[model samples]
Target chain A: MSKLYESQKLALWYFSVALVLFGAQLLFGLLAAYQYLNPDFLYGVLDFSINRMLHINAMIVWLIMGFMGGVYWFLPIETGREVVGIKLAKLAFFVLVAAVAVVVLVYLLVQTGKGDFFTLWFITEGREYIEAPRWADWGIVAVMLVFYFNVVATVIKSKKLTGILGVLIIDLLALAGLYLAGMYFTPNISVDQFWWWWVVHLWVEATWEVLVGVLMAWALMTVLGTPRKIVEAWLYLEVFLVFGTGILGLGHHYFWIGTPEYWLGIGGFFSALEPIPLVAMVVHAIYDAGSHKLRAANKPALFWIMAQAFGNFVGAGMWGFMHTLPQINLYSHGTQITPAHGHLAFFGAYVTANLVLMYIAIQRVRAPEGPALDSRAWKLAYVGFVITIFGMVGALTVAGFAQIFVERAVGGATWSAYIAGQEHPWVREPMYWRFGFGVLFLLSYLILIYDMLTIGKRAATATEVKPA
Target chain B: MIQGVEVLYLIGAGLVFIAGAGLYALLYAYGKIKGSILLQRSSYLFALAMLGGVAYIVAHPAFDTFWKSLLTVCGLTYLFIPKSMLWVMERVHLREEEERKKEKHNPFYTNY
Candidate 1:
């Protein structure tokens, strides 16, 4: 067995926590889908709003956890030194996990709007994904500060300043900066919406894009022995592309939110451009793999990387572009189209990025030579990936299109009318499809977690069984 | 109600579009070029120029429909140029590799 680094053990613990949260996220996702089919499925026990909040909150928290874990694992390797403040890193993990636990407990138990400030602190700010209470937000920010300090200190101490490290550090700092935008509360809806996009759009489309690029570049170089020059060049291009286009892409959300008419053109045009980087990434990976005859070691990692590329293109890129236009978004704004894009985009972009990181960490610790193609875990994971991807894309696309057609295209324009239209058979039927697919998605994650846990043990047993 | 300077801006947008297309062509020919350092450098410069143009446009007077259209076209062109470049370069590289493989296997071929 390969000797694991101490920092890597911290990463594994983070991954284990993230995996559990991922499973919890899927459970809440299924519950939300179930509510769509049968609104009374868990009416009082777990309301739709609560379920949806849990789902989104769990996803955002877990993905951040995954990113933090990945940073800890890769930073030491890139720096050629032990992680600075190892104790602080572990503390950050525990603090974050504890914060999540408190938030989840509060979300499940406490009811909001009791006219009490204490409830507000414990319950939430009541915004969509930023629903975590003020206290939870403070906890998250605190943990993030510790993580940021550790990463920055490590980089500053290192002699070499690689392009990947530069991008990662800048991106992490920006992530911390942008997250503060969500903490401020205001009565002005337009101002609130503007800053919210600073957190949401910037984090998802801009900062996270840079993070993914650098991390993916590093992984490709480390695993495939791809030339650093080429990967670094692509990283630079990605930074240019993301910041140049993605910042203006925020104009898209500004469209119907009482913002200026000019945002319509800016948002539509710039957001349309957002997909170009994703497409470039997919092409970059394909070309790099073809040009280099590197060993296909760590097949699962490679598969997830490709999935990250293609999935982001389709989910965040294509699906996002679909409704990003002012005309289309005018109709699809609050409809199921939003959630459809949300599900696929988040899954494709962040979820697969985390999975790729996890697979890399797993391959490093468990199977340095590479896991066998026909290993039970690998086979099951492949099936799980396919089922989850198809399940999400198929169900969500059907649901979103059905929503646009029934609620907006045919029905009248008012919000009440849209809500009434959702009751129609056409709209509600596709939701059942989403529910079914959600089950498959949950099952896929269960299989993935099992595979993650047992792959090393099974490999060791196989080696023992073989003749020496 | 297009001013003379706005017309110049429109013309500048057109020029940028053409420049973007030209950059795409250069990127497509990346394999034939000895090194991509120049290509990479040009991409950065192009990105900087685009940022400058965006700043200039945004800082000017209120954006009418025509100006909005101009900016929109410029942004779209800016977005696709690099992507198209990457796509074309990959294809060109693949084609070159295939040709090299064919040349190597030719029975009549001899190393100098």
Candidate 2:
């Protein structure tokens, strides 16, 4: 197939995988949240830590797939050239598919008592092991190289490239850093734990934040009919703020470890500023949308974009700053407050940003000339997402604060103290509400799936655009 | 015994890691709030200075706990907190034309 066809195919492949993964994430999230409420909901079958691992791993992979899809759509626009190598792109796709299957297979095998290659968690069995073999780890890394090569090759061949390519290059370099970091460490949780964050937390939060800023700016500009140059300038400023100051924020994760208290202070201080770019995102988005509100009366795509910008501001920027203080983070780092920052920042900012990319991709590929968000159903999904996100953030924040109070007042300093404190009425109260609100989030996904399928179908047939 | 050196190595490694991470955080915050390339550039330079200081202390292995701890804490706090929180939100505004319209509460509102 031609490169254009291949790009379309790859785009669909990414969206399909992402939706499936998102579905899995919603289910696992519900399960994990359920465990918190009942504590015995699936006690015998699935342990909390194991389920937690799956929840996080699934969320990460799905988001990565979404990012991959977004960049494929973006490369053409940023470079003004179709991606160069069709076969290589397809090869990367197949590898990624196999890699995911390997992960799922490994997860299931780790759950069962068949084999034990790499322990996943310590539930009661012979320790949790990698559901897939170690080669799968290296295999995924190889696939990453393939992806980096494809994008780099395309950009190198293009006569002109935008600073957007700088964003992509940074992601590539970070992945390389993560791979090297991964190999530098061992699988032992005790020692490997901190270094793993070097890849997991830092790479995802810092480098990926840069990528999201650029991609979101690109997508919003396209959908809002804003100028590319204007968007590019905003993107450049955001990227500089993120990397220029964001890399140090990684220290926040290092605090409780054997690392010095100084790290906690520094991490806390610098991360306070981490939200500058996020604040900029929200401010810019609100301004753009509000300015165009009268002109662009149609609000489906723009609504989601605006919502994403606002969500990122609160989720990534404000909430992140709240915990960046050493005094606060000292108490909240491993506790529920971390999750409060996590759910919003990850879901609200990062994932929602990617979703906007999906919306733009569909709009562009289909070339719908009519008013965006014409369908009542799509509007419902957008509102559903907003409501669900708001509910989750509110619930989690209250729960986190309750947890901190209980830990300090009732639980004391030992492991037993912490566990005993879990039984407190205050802690238990918010746990129930958090789980209750989580169900609303699950329902939102059902609406999203339905809306995504029917997006471009009824567009007056006069427009001959293909459905994404 | 090998165990003694192992413990020392671990401690030394921990100090180095924390120092590097902490310095980076300070540099980032300083650069971001100022929106000054010069400030950002100088922050990176200061981070290098912190690294060098930490390396010196590690290599020297002094027992002046009070001084070392004070330096560490001071370095860490400086590394993390931007010299000015007042301008951070405002600098965030300067990045985008759209954001400036919505928020007039810039920390530098009076000066500007």
Candidate 3:
């Protein structure tokens, strides 16, 4: 497990890119948070719309890079072959990096253009998360296709299709194919939204989750030296629960989007069940920790995976269930509750998943022929994790609940309700707390980066390596 | 009356109930695993205490029949979800074993 294939070096490149983008995402996120408290903070210099777009887009780019990096790193490990088209894969990497840089420059420098097809094609499509403009979208698709082709060829060459790689290919295909769902425009707003949710909801809820499943299974095996049968068993069970609940869980989003009345029942019912899988995953982690006598060969990597489990449970499962029921969504829709759920879910599920891979990758690449490195930064990062997950998320949740009551529950979406919700003491006060925690998160990111910058290069004495 | 934490508490009750139930499932499934008996037993104790908290949350002045019923269903479903997961795991393991046997290789480690 400590030894990495030489081809795994390509993954480090992707992770390094991801690290920069993740930092940018955080900066933009903090900017958006500040704008919430003070709209005039950036004023015309950097509009909230622009800042928020960068925040979200940067997040998507960085997290996807994490996925690609993890896949590249592990594919060789699983299949016993280096990635096919390695030179092309690296070329695709540059194309993607350049495309991201161009898109951001265009977003900031050229901000907006006419709403005609030209703007849609070149400048901005004005969609929420996938706002990379149409041309860039095509470029992204091409890059992903290269990544996909490399993975497929390697799997074929390996002549061995383990459960993890098998599911991984299917997920990669779905991942690439689903991005197309958000590319085109529709005449009807509902139809447009329907397709939009295909990209947004399905990616996070479906493909990304399956991707996490594969990665998590591999990670547990690598870190815990758990038997393949047990991990694969959990993988299959997770797939069962995720597809059973998450697909229809999109019904919650469908409820108000001009969908059928049946969605109310379906969405409410399925979304409630959504938390079941997350809880189940958390339980499985407990089982592993208990059965293994509470030790992981790679503690930092396992810590993030455990964080993914609990964080996703509290954030996506519990927080989502707190409001996703049609009855509750009635009052919490479009409130800060949405962000409250989103921040935790994204941080818990995907961000932690990436961190798990990064920690593992860093560990492998940093000290290949040596004992396990000390988890100096992880100890510090743990504090940041709590501050962000608890302090920041708690602030937003309270703000959301406050807004839900003032705006949706009592005021019922009236004009006055919007204003009252905005002015509510609960809502306004929590923003300051959110900003405070965000600063702490920044400090935490610096500590993590410090670790990233100088892990394993030191001459310090090595920690005792546990037998995996 | 209805603006603040009353609703938040209801959500907390349902989640707490689920956590307690999930802990029970973990204890039952992995209670024999080494060194966690006290941890699991204390967790079981907390699970029992959580029930009392759920009761208080439900009995709050917001206690309407619909809310109470919803809470009940949430509690019961979670109370059994871990059991259901265990059953599903057993079934999955059996299927995996069958697939591996038929293919004469571990399905997870080799193509089946």
Candidate 4:
């Protein structure tokens, strides 16, 4: 194992924290998936809503943590200087983790019926994505500010303004700014829905898209030996595509909402363009790989990078565009189709990007001697990735299509009809398939984590690591 | 309520739109074309046409169908305008790069 800079070490700690939260998130996700088949399985001990809230909140928190870690690890390298405010960065990490712990505890211990004023401060807001209480929201903002400040300070102090870092900084600022939209309360449901999506859709589709692009550019340059000039040029194009189409793409959510009617066309057209950048990304990755004789050493990291590209294109790009149109969304809204898109999109774009960063960090700190591709950890992680992707594409997609067919196409679109449709053989059968795949996905995640832990030590002990 | 004819029209329009999009994607994915700006902007026209056609066919003013039609027309128009703008931007960038390269080859050119 090679020694790492202080900031990079701090980033590894953040990665470890993210992994812990990720494991917990998947556990809740499995439970939530089970609830889809048997709502009464968890009953009083854990309501479906509560289970869902935990599952999503954990996913969001861990992904953000992973992003933060990536920024810490990469910023110094990109800027050619050490990260600023090292102590404060550490403090911010602890504060963020503490906030997540408190939020999860409240979700578990406190029920939201007739709560006292104090309990109100601690309880969830019952909103999707932004379910954390006001205090936790504020805490998240503070932590983000600290982290953001540290990143910007390091970049500015280094006087190295690379395009990749510039995009990342812009994305971080946008992420923090958009989060404020979710903090305020609104009595009107339309107004609330409007702001809710500003946070969710903009973060996932716009800012995070840019983040992924910048990170992918960095990884291509580092691992594939792609020229910085070519990567940055593509990054510029991505920035334009993401902001130009992605912001307007938020209109898709407003189609059925009480918003103005014109949003249907505006959303349909613009959001339809959203997949272009992702497709471009896949092309970019392929072009870079084909053009350069990449270092065969970091094949796992390279595999992840390629997966991130392909998966984002298929999941976020194709699958997202599949139901993004107003006509299709009219039928598929709030069905299993939504989760089908969410799982693949999140995993492909953000999750895989983070895993690539994790691999890089692991290699840098622990296995600097050589590649650990032959380690049991890498093989298991690869297997897990395959299983998870198959589960999402095969099982979840089948379930989503079945849901749309039975509930909306056949069941006449009433709430009771939809509930009854859940019991249909077509729907129920695919859901069981989803459950089996979900278990496999969970097992894969565990094996991947074990690989991360043991791969470094095993590589250190052995003189030569074989390629898997 | 959507009639049988309207449903068929909607389905046909959707199929046309999907076919156009699928073909456009294949062009980019297979490296038959490069630089997505032009191809993607062109693809939006198909989507807008489909949305407008659906709005006209359904004619069920529910969910703001009329506004949707208006927006689709506006979007289609906007796509062309941006294509031209991006073309100019690319030209300027390429020109600047050329000038920089020329200067780099001139031995007398040095920072003051």
Candidate 5:
């Protein structure tokens, strides 16, 4: 293995913290899942609302950190230079860590405050995913600014800006800029939600997909050893398709948000097309690996990325399409059906993408010890991924279907119908399945963290595999 | 008196399941994913889920024959779509192969 770059080493810090947050996120997720099965599981100790808020926030933050870590790990290699602002990058990491710690403590210790400016600024933002208070939000912006500076500066110093770098820079800016949409206050609930999707929908569907395209670009370069020209061409095509479809796909979200009815058509048509680029990329990877027999150094990373593509198609593309049509959305809007999409889409797109990146970094950090694909950690994560895709997503789909059937289709879409939806065995039974699968995923997540944190120590005694 | 909305949803949800699981079938046909027991089993679980789904539509007290028939059609759609997708992909691969042969016959046909 080659000598480790300083920039890549910086990735370890980001991944470590990201994993900690990932753990916290899933644990909270398990609690929330259980609360559905047993509403009194934690009672007031860790209420479902607080637990859910923690889960969503942790997921968003950890995924962002994972994205940062992936870029920090891959950029130096892509550019053949150290990160330009190494010292500042380190400081940003710590300060972001401190901010996250304080915010979590606030979320846990002082769950809510008076509904005033002071509360919104310092206590909680009261948003779904972007629940960090205004002060924490600003701090995040500061950290993101540092991240952007380091990233852009490194590319500038490299003097070799490829398509990937160009697209990455623009996407990074959009990713950061869109967060502000959620930070604002407005009197109109309809208007507020209109822009809110700019942050949530745009982040998940548009900017984040572009970011994945950029990261996957590098991953393919590493794994398949594909030519830069060919890779860049695909990246451009992918970017073209992603932004082309995904930008307008926000209409799917607007279908019920008191937006104009035209959104139903626009969102339905475009959002339906969002899966094509991802599935295309995954197929290309398979073809390259199968036809070329290109042995990726870290097969687990490749495997997980492949899983992510399939998961994305299922979660975001298929499930989303099922409900995006205004006709369908009318019945299923607020039901468990939404969570069915949310769970799989978030896990498939961002969570697995992070897992892929984490394994890639782990391989480099533990290079020449043994192939990481052959490790206990990879095995564990793979099991977790399976249980999640099948158990978590599949079970949720059943539950969502049940909710749609009982709560809306049969129940006249009434208030009492919503309550009746909760008691139905079809809906309630799958919550247990979801909770069980969630626990398995958490266990796998813990083992992965243990493997990552201990890989350094274990590398000392690990025997290297000789060439076959 | 069956209208269009819920029927469309039931069918759409079925297709979602079909494609979600059936996608792996396409991958399998393409030889993209092979010999991985985990993925293979994962796909099987995905397929079995369709049965579970069909059962819900079939036996749910709220649903009448209209719903059941619609859902049954979804099961039929699921059964056929994967094979059709694979067959279509096979034609694509066949055409690609034909193009390769024609290029190979030309002396000046250089990949470079």
Candidate 6:
């Protein structure tokens, strides 16, 4: 009964890997943005295809790791059972890491065109199934199965299912669909674009959104002492709003992909509905906090969960919905506005959830004494969330909205056209303001890393009475 | 577009929507009465109808455009599902009933 949930440790391992990927993503993002201003910034060092792949791939991996960790940390508590198998959980983690490494290797090899990997998928002389050197894709599938087995075994043994299970099962099924869809895609750019969004855009906005929403509800209940009944009720309501509006939200991605005009309505209407769950989450979180007078056992974790709920609404829901109108998405899809969705949705729905879970993980492992937490550390993390998320959102939105005019209306007529059309106006900002905001975000990451590492005390603390 | 094959597409879509709406209405009524059994039955039936509608849209050549197929599919799904979405609505148990007694005795929370 007292066995430690090995799943949490495995999740943490993935979290570390995710952070490394994030660092790489950040570097690529900076370079990608800079290329607009200076197309030849790193001509030989970074290939566009490779860097874009890494940026998008890393972002996806990081979000997945974060969600996995959050689920691992919180599921047991929600279900009132210790994790079933420790060894299988650890095995799954190693498999995933190996899979990720294989992917990076394959991506690099294909970029160089130095091997048989390039023509394997669509052309002849492709790698044979087990012998094809396409180990990465196989590795990923294997990893998924391993994880599915472990999670399923645990759920069956526990004999108790949380709302988390409902959302999780759907995501798992969606993952299978996405993978299959990816394989079946042809080489046509427009068709590729359509299929690509089915996997990438739909996964994040629709499937993952449901999982994140349900998990947040569970987290709110755990940290804020909200009754399970209320949280469960909210989850039920959220499912209707999420699926009713979410499944077709993928149509938002279909606008510029040579798809038909009718999708505009499907995408537009559903994208508008995308905000419903986000707003519901905010309402649920607030109601929980107010009901308990903002009393939280782990205040920092609670803060992040709430922050995630808020940012998700504003960034993904509000900003995104505004651009979902056919006319707007038509102009906004490839512009800076896409980044506005990327920045907020990534941080708000995924990163924020992980941050809260990380705090909780630190607490459980450290076994803090009494009600006293490391206040400085908590403040540092909260501040980190603020600076990074706020800067990214603010800058990206301005850049996005500004690009609309240059790209669509003016069509790059002159010097202003060349500059604005070519890139976001990051260079146009006052030097001091840009420097200040940029430095603030860098410092925020540094502070966050420091805070998380230093959460544990030096010596064993005296035991405190457990709460009932 | 309203020729023989096109008219067949329209008819198929119409039937899917009508069946879906009927099932959804039944679920909504059952939900209002707080009858979990009837609600669950309606939900399953409605989901089947929705899936069938999506299939119809996908197979029909006249509705091959991404936008139209997506709209009709989504419309059919929403139309078939009850507005309250009782399938997903958690029952707010105000007090214990004979059937509720089973869940109340579930050892997970009490044993902990």
Model 2, position A297, has a per-residue lDDT of 20
* Residue lDDT tens for model 6, A27-46: 66655655544568667667
Global lDDT of each model?
Answer: 0.70, 0.62, 0.77, 0.71, 0.73, 0.59
Candidate 3's DockQ: 0.21
Candidate that would win on lDDT: 3
Q: Chain A TM-score, candidate 1?
A: 0.94
DockQ of each: 0.05, 0.03, 0.21, 0.08, 0.08, 0.03
Comparison by lDDT, 3 against 4, better one: 3
- Candidate 5 lDDT at A459 equals 48
- Which of the two candidates, 1 or 3, achieves a greater DockQ against the reference? 3
Residue B56 miss distance in model 2 (angstroms): 37
**TM-score of candidate 1 on Cα atoms, chains taken together:** 0.81
- Compare the candidates by DockQ and give the number of the best one: 3
Off by over 4 Å in 6: A1-3, A31-39, A75-86, A105-134, A412-420, A423-439, A456-468, B1-112
Stretches of candidate 1 exceeding 4 Å from the true structure: A292-295, A370-374, A461-468, B1-84, B87-112
True-vs-predicted CA distance for residue A308, candidate 1, Å: 0.7
TM-score, chain B, predicted structure 1: 0.47
Compute the interface RMSD for each candidate structure: 13.5, 14.6, 6.0, 9.9, 9.9, 13.4
Lowest lDDT sum, 10 consecutive residues, model 1 chain A, at A366-375
Better of 3 and 5 by TM-score: 3
Sorting all predicted structures by lDDT, with the top scorer first, yields 3, 5, 4, 1, 2, 6
Error of model 4, residue A8, in angstroms: 0.5
Clashing pairs in 6: A262-B67, A263-B67
Q: Give lDDT tens digits, candidate 2, residues A94-126.
A: 888877776666565456554343342222223
- The 10 consecutive residues of candidate 3 chain A with the worst lDDT sum are A459-468
Q: Weakest 10 consecutive residues, lDDT, candidate 5 chain B?
A: B103-112
Best by TM-score: 3
